[model samples]
Target: MDQEKVNEFLGRFVADLAATEAAGSVVIGQRLGLYRALAEGPATPEEFAERTGCHRRYLTEWLRGQAAGGYVAYEPKTGRFSLTEEQAYCLADPNGPNLPAAFLIALGMLRAEPRITEAFRTGEGFGWHEHHEDVFVGCDAFFRPGYAAELIPHWIPALDGVDEKLTAGGRVADLGCGLGSSSLLLAEAYPRVTVAGSDYHADSIALARKKAAEAGLSDRVSFEVATAQTFTGTGYDLVTMFDCLHDMGDPLAAARRVREALAPDGTWLLVEPNASDTVEENFNPVGRLYYSGSTFLCVPNALSQPGGYALGAQAGEAAMRELIAEAGFSRFRRAAETPFNVVYEVRL
Candidate 1:
């Protein structure tokens, strides 16, 4: 290799090492509530410590790290730290849609590092049945209500003719339904449509049943313990999977199951974490972030090859279409696209 090129490579490697250590700063700041406190204006380190109930020395160290990582700004003369308007939007305001609750879910996965290690060694996920129970213990109250009250109302209508189609009773099933958020929303929206929420986790089914009852949709919506691989219930007009297909070990098998369960002309909807449009797109910063996050959380389940879980190659639209077709779907089209996800409607 050229000497100058070699030197540049080493320089980049050293910078990557530094970045890895700083990666946890965002999580730490969020857990400490420091970002929320500094949202309005700058504050002296001592004031920040008082506001967050932390020792001044510890606050100073944290602020220095955050500033160095570009998550916060610091003024040496004023001895103060502050969040920019962007930071305030993304991290501080609880009501703001920019808030990073996804990171909280990511951090929760980190707590399962030991399980991840075991899965890696055995080439199997910790098992979604057990994992879901641990993951959603306290998550339902926030996820179900938040998505229904905020995201669904705004976004679901964007699907072409979806609102009109949902007006009358239409059969809907939420595959890999966590706490029945999507199913409950559909149940609440269309009193006539029967919605079924299914997951491999027994605890999740129990919780989903409880929430559906509380939402007064017990009659219209039901919960069941089922895995995507073996899921079988036919004659459904629509089937939906939200933020879950990537986590399955056998997504194609699950997709096939969904196809078998659908009405002859049924629609199969999938919402998954965004991937790049091409291999070159993965070079971009945002794409890199998405890919890294999936590696740590989403794609590993596929790699593990457990029952019901199938390993999926990281891919974009073309790759997704191929998988859907392999699963026996006749046609596929993009129903919606967002910065964070891609929604597809496949026809049976």
Candidate 2:
């Protein structure tokens, strides 16, 4: 290889390794409220310790690392660290993107590296319930913000006649509704509709029910422990799968189930990670992130179940359209899109 090209590849490798090291530090900062404290104002390590009651030496190291990673702004002259407005939005504001929490999901999956490696060798499957609790919690935390921002005002309205149907006292089934975040958002938005959310993981369903109770929406939103293919429901005016269809081993079966569950004029709202049909076309930063998640989480979950189709996170719209058509759905249209998700409206 050319020496310059080798050196460039080495630089990229080093940057990636550094990012991997920083992932744990990001999780720690989130757990200890370090970013939020720093967002309050610029502070020396000792001042940070005083505000958060954390040890000074550890705070100093974390702050320095964060500053070096461009996650925080460092002031050498002032001997303090702070978050920029963008940093605060991504790291400190829980209602904003809360980008740091995404690392927790990565860390959680990494904890199962040995098991995943063996799966690679044996072609065995690792189920979702088998992963660390951080995976579940981190997933909810990471996706909730996007749902909060877009689900009501944008995604719902984008669906043809679904928003009006919901407003007029319709029924909804939210499949793969982890922790009920999307389900709760829908119930909170449309007072007339009742939402039935289901997930295969019992723990996630339990937590979802608890969250529904906490939101005082227990009456309007209900959760059940059931897989997408086996969920019990019928005559739903709207059926929603939020960033989850690709994870199912039998997504076609799940799609057929959704078709059966919906009313005659019902709409199925499918949300998946945005991607192109060609591999080279999805070689950008977002695709890189999703491909990693697919390898570590989504594909493994799919393989662990019956059918084991493994339609990864970047399976793209063409593949999804084919699956919908095979499931006996006659109409499929792209409804809306965000940087991270592609929403489809399906009908019979």
Candidate 3:
């Protein structure tokens, strides 16, 4: 290779290593509650140790790692560590509006390391049905409410006149609904609409039911144990798959079934992590993050076989249109796009 190419390759290698090290900093800070402690003010390592009940030496090491990762500020003169206002909002306050909960959830999937290897080798997802509990339990509290109270409000209205489409008496099916947040939002928004939340995980279904009941939405919302590939409901005015399309083992089959479930004028909405337009572009940091993170859980099921879930990186907008057309949909349109997601509205 030319010297310029060699330099580019080496730079990427170093960046990858740095990213991996940064992941450790994230996990340790969260586990130690160091981010929360640093939210209020800069504290001497000794003061932080006293408050968090950890040895000063160990806490100092942890603080230094966070400082190196740019997640905290360290002052050598004062022997103190603190979170900047940005970090405080993003990491310190668990319930803060700017919390990085979704990013953390993706990171936690790294626990499925060995299983990721098996999936890569076999072209199948390993132990997803078995590890569903650990996966969801680690993320539900942070992600569920954030999706309901924040993301939905911002994205749902962006759909092409979706408010007028929903008109309060339509049937709405939430495919691969995790913890029922999106369904609950729809149910709460349109009191006359009946929302059905479906997932392959039984525990998730139970949790969804429990949450819907607790929210006094049980009358308008229901939960079911169903997989996207085999979902058989019909006459739905609208169907949504939120960040869950890429988790289906047979996305083509699921898409076909989704098409079948829609009324003649119904809408099928597919939402997933945004990927770039080419494989080379997929190697970018954001793409690498999504691709590597998916290996442990989503990508295996998504990219399991040909015609399965194609990463947007490898298959761009044109490919998505083709996939929808192949699934028997009459038309496909980019309904909306967000910072990290794209929403495609498919019509039957």
Candidate 4:
């Protein structure tokens, strides 16, 4: 091996491991509400401990790590730690983008690394429901903000006539609606419509139901335990699959089921992980995350059922159009997109 290249890779490995450790610290801070406490204002370890009821020594070390990691701001003169506006948005503010939720999901995957390795070697696969509850919780927290920021205002409006239909009154199904974030969002946004959130994980459905009841949308928004291919419904004016199509073992069948479930003039709004159509086009940070997430999580879930097509989290717009077309959706087009996701509109 070339000594220079070896050293280069060694540095990269250490950097990656450090980032992983930082992610672990992020999870801890999220779980303990340290970021929320700090968001209130600058504080020394003792003051922060008082704010959060955590031990000061442990809090001091964590703050130092966070400061070194550049996640929190530190002052040499005041000897205090705090969050900048941007950092507070990403970490402490739940109404904004809760990116730490993604890190929490990564932490859940780390716990299943051993089983995932065995599955890789043995040609066995795991399902989404097979993972720890942390995965579900993280997913809900991570995706909910984006849904809140865009679902009705941006995504639904982009689809022709769908918004008007939902506004007037309609039946909607939100497939794979983890924790009812999207489902509840729709029900809250469109009072005239009824939203049914469905997922195969019973635990997630239970939580979604609880959330609906908590939101006092129990009558307008309901959650059921079902998969993409097994959700039983008909005459749905609109159907939504949010960031979950690539995780289906049989996306084609799921697409067909949605088609059959929709009214003849209904719209199917499908959201997926954003990716370029070609492999070489996806050589970026987002691609890296999606590829890693696919190998460790998404592909395994897709493979858990028959076919094991393993479309993966990086399957791009081209792949999605084909899937929709195969299900007899003649009209397909790009609806809207963020750096992290792609939205598509499909209709008969």
Candidate 5:
């Protein structure tokens, strides 16, 4: 190999390594509320520590590392650190993109790297319930902001006539609901519709029930511990699966169940990761991130179940359309899309 080319590759490798190592620091910063404190105002490490009741030396090191990572701004003239508007939005604002929660999910799944590695050798499967608790919490936190921003205002309205039906006190079934974030959003937005949220994970279902009670929506919103294919519900005006269909071992079965659960004139809102029909078309940064998540999380969960099919996070629209059609759905159309997700309106 040419020495110059070797050095260039080494530079890229080191940058990637640095980013991987920084994931933990990002989680710690968020856990300790360092980013939020920094967003409040510029400060030296001592001042920040005083403001947040943290140790000064540790804060100093973290601040320096965060500055190196371009997550925060540093000033040599005054020896102070602060967050830029973009950084604060992503790292500090509770209603922002919640970038740290992504790191939390990554670290949580990586904690089971040994088990995942063994599963690779033995062809055994790793279920989502077997992963760290952070995986559950982080998954909810990471996706909630986007759902809050888009689900009510855009995704629901994108479905033809579904919003009006919901407004008129219709019923909804949210499969693979996970912590009920999407279900809660639906109930909150429409106020008249009742939502039934289901997940296979008992813990998730329990927490979802608790959240519904806390939101004072327990009267209309309910949760059950059930898989997508086994959820007990029928005659739903709208059925929804949010960023979850690909994780099922038998998504085709789930699709059929959704078809059965829907009312004659109902709509099925299926949301999935945005991907291309061609694999090569997904070689960019977003695809890279999704592929990594699929490898450790989505694929393993699907493998752990009964069916052998593991339609990964980047399974693409053509594959989804075929699966939905095979389940006896006559109409399928792209309803809406964000950079990270694609929404499909499916009808019987």
Candidate 6:
């Protein structure tokens, strides 16, 4: 081995260990509202402890860790720490755009590591429902801001003539709706449209119901415990699947179900991870992020079910278009995309 390359690899290993611990700290701060509290102002460890009523020693160590990680600025002279405006926006404010909620997703994955490891050794699979509770919660939280920022304002409008149909009280079925974030957003945005959100996870459906009630959209948006391939009700003017199709056990069957459920002139909007059919083309930060989840969650979930076609998270546009075509949908086109998602429009 080249000594220089060996040294570089060793340095990366050390950095990775620190990064892993840093992510754990981030999750703790996020869950305990430490970041939120500190965003109020610079505080000595004692002051932070007093304000938050947390243990003094714990806050002290956490503060030092955060400062060392450059997440919080340390005032060595005063032994205080503070968050910059950008840090506050990204770490403290959950409602803000740059919020970092992936730590929660990481926590869920870490919690599932044992099962994932077992599955890996046994050549078996694990269900999405088998993940830590935070997996769905974190996923919903992580994607909520983007959906809120884009879905109705941009994505919905981007679909050809679907906006008018929705405004005219056309029905929508959001398959694999998770916690119903998109469904609730749609009902809120288009007063005339009736939205039905469905998920295979009973727990997620229960949470979705609670969320709809809290959003005061229970009247217009209803959630049901149903899978994409077996969801009831038809004549939907629009059907949506967000960041979920690839993880499906039988995405082809799901596509066919979406087809049968659609009205003759209906639209199907698929929002999947931004990647390419070619693995070499997907070698980037976003692709790396998706592949990590695919290995631990998406692939396992798909394999757990009957269908062996685990398309995985990096299923890209080409694969998706081909799958939709195979499902008998004639018109499929790339309707819209962001750096993070690829949105396709399907029409019968």
lDDT of 5 at 170: 97
- Among residues 3 or more apart in sequence or in different chains, the pairs in candidate 5 whose N, CA or C atoms overlap within 3 Å are none
lDDT of 1 by residue, 11-85 (tens): 988877666665466657666777888886898888887788988987888788878868788888988889988
RMSD of 1: 4.2
What is the per-residue lDDT of model 3 for residues 1-348, given as tens digits with 9 covering 90 to 100?
599999999998887777666766665666777778778689987899888888898887778877876878988898888988888977876556434455466565766677776766776645355554546754565555556654456666666656666864889899988778788888887777898889887887898899999999998898899888766579998898887766665677888888888888888877777776666877776676667656566666556444545443234576677777888888788777755567787787
Question: Model 1: runs farther than 4 Å from truth?
Answer: 1-7, 97-160, 184-194, 203-221, 230-234, 276-281, 303-313
Quality of model 5 by C-alpha lDDT? 0.94
Cα TM-score per model: 0.77, 0.99, 0.83, 0.97, 0.99, 0.97
Q: RMSD in Å for candidate 4, one decimal?
A: 1.3
lDDT of 2 by residue, 1-348 (tens): 699999999999999999999999999999988889889999999999999999999989999999889999999999999999999999999788888779999999999999999999998889999999999999999999998998898999998888898999999999999889999999999999999999999999999999999999999999999999998979999999998999999999999999999999999999999999999999999999999999889999999999859999999999999999999999999989989899899999
lDDT of 4: 0.91
Candidate 6 lDDT tens digits, 1-348: 799999999998988789888888888898789999999999999999998999999999999998888889988899889999988988887777534578888778789888888888997989999999988988998899999988988998999999998888989999999999999989988999899999999999999999999988898999889899999999999999999999988999999999999999999999999898889988987888789999999999999987778998898788998899999999999888999998899999
lDDT of 5 by residue, 1-348 (tens): 699999999999999999999999999998988899899999999899899999999999999999999999999999999999999999999989999999999999999999989989988879999999899999999999999999989998898998888898999999999999999999999989999999999999999999999999999999999999999979999999999999989999999999999999999999999999999999999999999998899999999999788999999999999999999999999999999999999999
> What is every candidate's alpha-carbon RMSD to the true fold?
4.2, 0.8, 3.5, 1.3, 0.8, 1.3
Model 3 lDDT, residue 176, Cα = 87
Count of clashing residue pairs in every prediction: 6, 0, 0, 0, 0, 0
What are the lDDT scores of the predictions, listed in order?
Answer: 0.72, 0.93, 0.73, 0.91, 0.94, 0.90
Please give me the total number of clashing residue pairs in predicted model 1: 6
Cα deviation of 347, candidate 3, in Å: 1.6
TM-score of 4: 0.97
By lDDT: ranked, best first: 5, 2, 4, 6, 3, 1
